[model samples]
Target: MSLIKKTFKTIDELKKHLKTHAPTFYYSSQTSTVIPYDKIADFFKNKEMTLGDLSQLPCSMELTPTQNLIVKGAISWKDAKDFLRSKKRNIMTSPTEELALISAGAATSATGERCFHFGNLRSQIISLTYLNFDGNEVKLNQDIALKNTSNEVKKYQKDYAQYDIFKNAPFPRLETQTDLMIGTEGQLGIITEIEIKTTDDFPVNHLFILLPKWEVDSKAHLEIINKVQKFRNMVILCELIDANSFEYLPKADRPNKEMDAIFFEIKTQSFNDFYEQFVLNLEYIDQDHVFELAATKFHNIRASIPRAVFEKNSQMGVVKKGTDVQVSVSQFETLLKIYQNFTKLGIKYNLFGHFGDAHLHFNFMPLPNQVELCHEQLELLYGHVLKLNASPFAEHGIGIIKQKYIPAFWNQNTFKVFKQLKDEHDPYKQFFPQGFMSLEDHS
Candidate 1:
């Protein structure tokens, strides 16, 4: 009866357990279907179905003397960071590390925007082990798989090269087969274990800048970002907060009326150089001498904005919907224009995020009755993003919620390739039955 205590070491055992106890369909009391366990039968017929409870798996880490870490997928980010810190090793911070810790067979920080601080989670992965739909385990490493999948890799690149959005955009290099899995969004397989490259622990310098709305126009912000790019190697984090976000902050901590803020974390060694080169007409409302505490405080503030929006909406019986959109650095001004247009329409929204990478999170808070209007606005906004050749789902993976928007990003041919990739790896759609492109869409 206790699912947490159950463990299935072999594929056959797992299959057998599931076939017997797992429900064919499990629905949430409120909205959508919660689980579709019956789909596994599509891949394996009459197998003894055993379901392994991954949550029961212990979190462990193996650290080499050199500081490289091999961590189990179920390990919490905070626990992993604490372990590394105990050994006097560096800890990389992914967005909301505690809440969005890496998932088994699932990738973290898949987008280029959030990874601006730390390298892409995929890039740091030296190797990984995953489970295919048939319950078979497959291990892959960066070097060997690259050579084996060279032709398919080339074709994948060539296909995307034809699209202006992907062709002109500054994409991170995909040097290995492991790299392709970074943004796969759990479609290919479930990642169980990961070997990651580590860095030498270094101190950081945190700085905060508050700019009045009039003074921090698109052109001025772009100029500041261009100057900051010179120290890209040293700059670990760069985030922008809009005026709407101040509602969550303390009255004393808030920026001036009609003003927004930018937070920066750079390696201490480059602090003086950054301070000297980065000249902007903004007020420094606060600066911290203690970098660690300052970075934590700023990160917490950034994390709280969403929760604040949700709580505020709940009290008013409204719902808040948010979208992540990213454009090439060249289209930063265009993206801002879209945001301004939305604001002019008198929509209640919050705009902020990693402007260094031209990724912004736009949240629309609408009453339950106004949900249709909010969605309509989102559709128009996405159309503009598409016109700019920007990605509507930038950092977040296109899970079930975003499935309806896929047609805008992919053509019939491109979508066909996506279906082929999914079918080849998971023909029965046993894993994450609703994520990425849906089975119904592929059919």
Candidate 2:
């Protein structure tokens, strides 16, 4: 089987082509996804399907007086950010990948630094237009939620009121049809345009705080984290780098290679008051360790760790294996303990990510022979986290690699709703046929 690549410059052209030859997989910049290359190649190995390149689509943006941004799906986060910056505005939250398209973010329900405050891409989307399975255009927005009169929706609301697909959402909310396209891993449709809410660009300070690993100094480390949490109102982003992950950090940035790090940002509108009260008053926090850098510089240093690990895995011919689990604030410490205890499995690993959201990435760097063992350990870990009521796949939606874990995440009742949604939106199963959930995994 061969994969044919097709590029579409306009929505009309895409819709026309889709009517005759529907694309099975879509590729834009492909810079942000963790889906393995082998998985994709293997998936298309036996099928003849066109791979649509959406990167060439219109990259336009229009900001309304009410701060709503109408953007074409092809625009990248970097371009969108630059456009927003010129207007002295910013999106609520975005992933770190600059080349990754904003539409990909919405499709994957992406989240990043400010997610703990504002929420994921799903929360920012006010409206969207997408091509359905039949090449027919469908538009959905907030207004549709009010006008929804379907019996299926009513039953879904009545039956699954207690269930939440995204467990870490700031608050519980009912699901609407519009929400289906946001995070179904591109299974439902192909998004062409989106309207997202934007916020004012506020000034902030980025700080990297070094602390001894919990195994080395638990009491002192816990105290520092507690102090940082006290100013939750002012702190926007708080991420961690465990001791094992320090090896991935650039040598110049690894001031204390043996110690862990917490990189956070403080809203600087009232910097003087916070500096005097927080930094000056704290004797435990080393003034020397609290280094301030520009937002870009800080993010680069933080991002370098994960990028290095990814490259290293590729070099070693091992598929990337990692967790995107997020638990309740109360269970966060327990999750940390479980991750740290994973070392007993004798597999090398690194842990880092959004500490504020109680979400962290625990990546396993396994040898070729250790891949099976690593997977067995991961299944056990998933089961344990499920017992703790954790979001097995948070922030990042369940792509191909994470599909096998869906059985553990969803029960029979919830699974039925998922299948029903799939049947309604993509009855032919043409879009990313192997992305999120498989038909056989339902039971």
Candidate 3:
């Protein structure tokens, strides 16, 4: 978003205010965790002055906030393993293997990075698994996580919506960056901090709309997704919902009131009087209409017409494969139309994917009674995705789910590059022998 006005900074005043408030903490807390808020509190109590005296906080200024974790005491789940190792000082059972799997799996699912690498194992999951490290370690002035994390993530996720606009922009500019790591399949990471770059002026204001499920037709979806690239102040992230899966969500499994909601973080100028106008746009989409959505994590599969999600079973043997392809938006549009049209021909697809980047996440689960017909449908639908240049190995990596369908996206040249990289990094291929090492199938 472009800046409308100018913002001037006074570094001297910013430092003066900090010195008065935190003479000791201002120097010590820069690179350390577990900053005791009591130190700053004692300073504030002595100053007799309040926070409002300053014109504004500096752009690069940071605050240290800490919390007393109820679940694991002072230690957070992110570094829980460390606590487990130090039996005398800390208390807990080390679920090292489980932690690794969760962090590794999150990285694989979110960004499609192909390896369970060592760095990912320690850095990613170690931070995410810990309840205290995620928020309490930051040392906030108030007790936020004392309630819940989803609450904190959502509140901040919404606050930082405008930040993702600059996501494809600069690397060092992201202050609210969170890391996701997976070791053998585990989730690790936390909102380490939020940074607001030193721009002359902040983003202009704009309106954001949250569209409900039924309103997510092809025409509206494309319009919203395309607007991000077109309008500088517009932000959109549509979250698809599946009713067939929602009814099965246990009352406890569902997210907060804002769950299953898309965010349209707007940044524009002259928004002071446009609040009413923005509400009109949101009301048109029926944002107030709340519905129960289904998730693969807890949704029941037995009662659904065709089961989409399945448990990873030891009895299941997977076919190894590798593929990666990038498709143009126009070509992807054609492919989506074909798939959407086939839905009428008694063909069912478990579809829930990110349209913002033109990535499709689909699973075939034909009716239990129609075995022969189901096979034909899978071939036809899978083939269409391949022909469009859309990778079958999209967002979700080519895990045990669609390994056999690798050929649909990979050409001879692309396949060769993957094999070459595989050999370079993993000559022995011990970490994941089945992954991309399809010696028989590649031939």
Candidate 4:
């Protein structure tokens, strides 16, 4: 599609623009993981669409220290962190994309490294302001306090359990309009501002534990991960760096090229506390294979893998294809077995991500000729994943690229309910015309 890109500096400007020209799509400022570039390029080639940019919306933030943060949607994660740091407070869990807009993360239900304990982006949100299809501003707030212990929230989850698409998603299900608006990928509304809960910014440290050769020592690697699983209380994030992903990292960042690694973060009050609670207690973890790094440096090293993957895809002129499925812990072993099939097919790939949550990203770096094969394999894999009742698009919301898979995920009745909800909220279908469910007449 030929996209007419426009940016608005204020909500008033956006409202004015909407009155004149209806935007068919909306995306954040950065072309980070949030944007579905391949879907837009391939699926809308013959269509002309106006793509609205929400990133330039006026920046404003109010921190209540240990309470909550009321911030404009356009505020970047880095800026939010900086502001919170000044007050000795921060979002309990933050997504890895520091440059991404916080509103984008909440809208897409993006998860952070510490998601296993603190929960995903949705957990942080207390209330949000969004513009509907008519460009009228509306705010949705949690009826009760933002706590999982609320009976209303639990009852809502139990009532809507049948319609839940992502089975293993974090708590606070579709209880209110706020829950519905989140993870809708702009299909419901354009998020303008958000109020999210915060926590004290305590100091922490990282542990990088090396593994034996992954391909040969697969059993050993799984056993190591099982060990890490027992220490969830102290560990904030338990990530896996498979051999394929390790190769893509810069030589300067890697400990060595010889082994895969299990990287995790832990609370660091003092040296003795760390040694007693984590170091000495984690059996089978040899001191020779383990080391520590500062949080900032460790994050940089971890972020490099995804950056390298995207760079390689760009260089090869191939569209990025990756899995974001999250299943129950019991099904994770099966998921790993399916990933191993990539070797049998001789497809070059990388597998890494939130090992603790049973959510991992498996990216395919196929040559032009191998793209078709990759698509076939992905379809088969997703089919298997659905059988396990996994959240097929776990961290990443279903943008245009993954919309085709929704039919299998949602029942006919559930699909109709969502369509009806969309019709009620956006009768004109002016917002995100062909997302989640296509309402446009391309013919």
Candidate 5:
């Protein structure tokens, strides 16, 4: 049967097709979770049996006159970004935006500052077309008006037993079905198509601030964060790179041996305004000192750190482990203290990420022998994140790797609601099985 035209009559049929045609869909035996299949060799090696070549999925991309892109779910993020750049337009989305959008249909990013809706991906979605668990097609309009009649309210009250859990939620407004599916991590349905808004490309002014090791823990760092927050409107991106991270960079790009750095990308139009309002007060830098670079070059330098870390781990035959933790801006100091403790423990790790949002990717490039120790440190790190009322999984959704932390992050009541939603939309758990929460027991 041609897989593209195959219409599944039952959930078992779908599972059978996936097992036969998409064997890479299963989770890793060691980790008990699914991860991205970036390398073709890894995919074949993990499956242990190659029935046939794994071909690219078919997809279509259409760009409207208004610059909106309507894309199929199978399109890779890099492809989408290339298409936008070809048209001299851009979507200020995170680096991992495409992975989540393709696999889960919804994703988050630190690039919200540049988005028209301020980083909420849902707001940029014009519509969605998906396949329900029962082999039915469903289309939802983003601007559809919802009716809240008494009967509808009663149904909601009855369906969601833990309504009280969200009673005091900051955004108390009820979410439409479209909103719910955006970040469900493919638990609800298979996203088939998406409509996304784009923005005209603009030049960005790059600024690099190198900080001494001592300032990482001092009040001076806090003052800098405060100043950045005060002028956030003018800054598009703010990232912090730890001293350890520089080890991964090329010799020419690495900073001073004892210094860490922060990279800022600000919209050039407001450069003068931001300089007068915030830059003049930055006590960390001397008044006459200034450092600048092309925005593209600055981002490339930042990207090289992770690339180097991964290459080092691959060479050592050890898996690279990392954590995406975000805490309240007020708790930045506490976050640094947690990082400091890890360093003191002799753990080999690097800290870098979107400091503008208090989210950092704590990547550990442990030697093969230090794998267990790396896991231990991750547990300790997550515990501290919870104590500070922060999220252990921020922009990255709870894929197979982070499924174990779901219970820790969400209360029983909240989890029950999640399960209920999953059950209602995907009763058999056929789509992206064990992505968010493991359904092994339930199955």
Candidate 6:
């Protein structure tokens, strides 16, 4: 039996609670992005005295310390209001611990469209300049919008969740990184700043290499996957993000549809330099040629998909498609075999996800878009994952998105312990309440 059913609270009731007590602690942190990332930038900005619809929509609410943290320093009063129009884009969002403190303002049951609605007039971006004096330094921070319109994309073109880098000129070895950043689906979240290290500025070029999406009859590539492990030792901030909403991206918006891919990033002094090094160290050279090559081959391996493959995936958005849970990072290869088998059964999906860890992503066919049907599909999908010791809730936490998936990953005894913890924290059930259905609570 499901321990949690929707509270059936009207939107008005949710808004009133948000307006009055202001539950800024819980709702605001993780779920805010379940909102606007439209190409929309700002409303009105000026120093002259202005008047808002002050009668009912009074500015009666107060911003808590953390919510107000970047408001003042990151942007100006005018820009702050501009920032709020979206109230849902950027880097790390306002943590949840802050939102629960407020009465809880407007909450919704949806996901945000990341049309890349990020800008820095209200925000600023800077890079690390080491004293040891690196090579050419590229200092670029351009506005981030949904489509690749402006020329400043060089400033903001981030690699897909993962990439690689060779040490020097000869570039015998290679290093790469994967992504797993969290987003607040509905509550307000934005990233004001991010920092990375690079040697010199050069045109970042890429080869959109499309390989035959053939099934691996034998267990190969495990060696290259392991080689990446050693290279990861030199990685800085790498994470693997796996969300199911990727299947929802409109066909018109998705970049490359011909391939099941992975998102990864790499760095080099120049475009030519990167390609030369990448070719010389052919750790993954004949990867598509799977003839049982001893999995004990290379020392350093760099695996990745392409940027055109990545941008479209990001635009597809970040919410999960159904009530599927996340899995842990270990049981990946086993899960892939099951997923591949499902694919052969006409369960079409795009598999461009994080392979560095077990939190990989695959976009299923939206043939029957009904939530229940999708979830039924997920039940079977996650069943396979869990049967092999994988958890559906790997990177993303348990929210309404994965409420139906709690049992798939945890035993009843483990669920009981979580409920006890919830009782201790928000005894009044006033915080994030039932929205994310606590796995800790079996009651």
CA lDDT of each prediction against the hidden true structure: 0.58, 0.73, 0.31, 0.72, 0.58, 0.30
TM-score, per-candidate, Cα-based: 0.78, 0.90, 0.42, 0.89, 0.77, 0.44
Output the number of the lDDT-best candidate: 2
lDDT of 4 by residue, 1-443 (tens): 48777888889888876666364687885454535565565555677777788888888999765569888858887888899889888776667767878888777777767786576666578889888776789888866443343444354456457425442342225666577677777777788889988877887788787776555556655665566566666677888777788788767777745677778787666545556665666555567888877887778867888878878987887777788888767777788888887667877888888887777889999998999898889899879976776777777767666665556655444444556557766677777878765532222
Clashing pairs in 4: 1-44, 1-45
Q: Model 2 shows how many backbone clashes?
A: 0
How much lDDT does candidate 5 score?
Answer: 0.58
List per-candidate RMSD values in Å: 6.3, 3.0, 21.1, 4.2, 6.5, 17.5
User: Which stretch of 10 consecutive residues in model 6 shows the poorest summed lDDT?
Assistant: 166-175
Q: Give the TM-score (vs. native) of candidate 6.
A: 0.44
Count clashing residue pairs in model 6.
Answer: 60
Over the stretch 1-443, how does candidate 3's per-residue lDDT look in tens digits?
Answer: 12111121343443343233211111111111111222334424543323221112232212113211122112222343243333322211111122222222332422311111111212222223221211223322211222233343344334334324211110011122223222111111111222111111223322223343322355544554444333323322223333332333455643423323332223345343333443334323554542323323312221221122321111122111111222345554565565556456663444443344444333434445444564565567668654543444433344333455555444454344445434443343322333333333354
| lDDT score at residue 230, model 2, on the 0-100 scale | 62
Ranking, lDDT, top scorer first: 2, 4, 5, 1, 3, 6
lDDT of 6 by residue, 30-141 (tens): 2222222131012112211111110121122223333432221122222323344344322221111222211111112111110011111112212211100111222222
lDDT of 1: 0.58
Query: Which residue ranges in model 2 land beyond 4 Å of their true spot?
Result: 21-23, 146-174, 218-221, 224-230, 276-288
Candidate 5: residue pairs that collide: 112-119
TM-score for candidate 4: 0.89
Q: How accurate is candidate 2 locally (lDDT)?
A: 0.73
For candidate 5, the C-alpha RMSD (Å) to the true structure equals 6.5
Q: For model 4, what is the alpha-carbon lDDT of residue 412?
A: 44
Score candidate 3 by lDDT.
0.31
Better of 3 and 6 by TM-score: 6
Cα lDDT of model 4 overall? 0.72
Model 1 C-alpha lDDT per residue in residues 234-352, reported as the tens digit of each score: 78877777788777777776543546767787889988877765633223323331123376677677777755775676676544467677777777777777777766655677777
Q: Which of 2 and 3 is the better model by TM-score? A: 2
lDDT of 4 at 159: 42
